[model samples]
Target: MLRRVREGLHRWPAVARLVAIAALLLVAAAAHLAARSEPAGRWLPLLVVAVVGALVAGAPRHRWPLPAIWLVATVLAVTRGSAVDPGATAAALGVGAVALVAALTADVVPVLRTRHRRGER
Candidate 1:
């Protein structure tokens, strides 16, 4: 059973990353709503995003920066979501989610397919 799961993930890496993002996004979105409900807490998520963005991007060795970028944008969505109605908010979030996945795919797939060719005899 576990082997099958591993093989499936290996064959479809995007699905694995997507499941992770979906799980985290649910929590972050809920956090957004909770923070909104409390006037004093509204800025906390945004502030956290800024701090983390600085920390992550500041380091050159953070090889995979896509997740960090997605996280910041997702948090930003919560901050700016107030101006729009619920339906529009959901659609916008959906678009952002797609963008996040697309960005990751664009950054990763080509590199994975490329061969170093340097060491090949």
Candidate 2:
């Protein structure tokens, strides 16, 4: 069973990323709704679009940057503007940004090492 799980992970990094992003987005969306004073204007719709944009780009090779970019945007918007509930946006966006950066960096480092190994051989 363990072996099977490992193989599945190897074959589907994208799925892992997709699931992670979806989970984070759920938390953010819920928080956005639950906040005592979320914006009454366009922030809700923008947040929705950001979540969907991340979802649509959830490929391991490509979507690696999507969540990070989304999170940064969210963070900036929250910090600079008075749209969404800052605390809720900060929590979800912070975690999502960090996780995506780590995952994508780890993924790329391995490829670079493998290429160097081939060159040496």
**Lowest-sum lDDT 10-residue window in model 1:** 54-63
In the predicted model 1, the residue pairs found to clash are none
TM-scores for candidates 1 onward, in order? 0.33, 0.43
For every candidate, C-alpha RMSD to the true structure in Å: 11.4, 8.6
Query: How much is 46 displaced in model 1, in angstroms?
Result: 20
Winning model by lDDT: 2
The per-model lDDT (C-alpha) reads 0.49, 0.57
RMSD of model 2 against the true structure: 8.6
lDDT of 1: 0.49
Question: How many backbone collisions does model 1 have?
Answer: 0
lDDT of 2 by residue, 1-121 (tens): 6456545655787875665566456535543443324553534565555555444444345545545555655555566556566566666576666868887887789899999999998
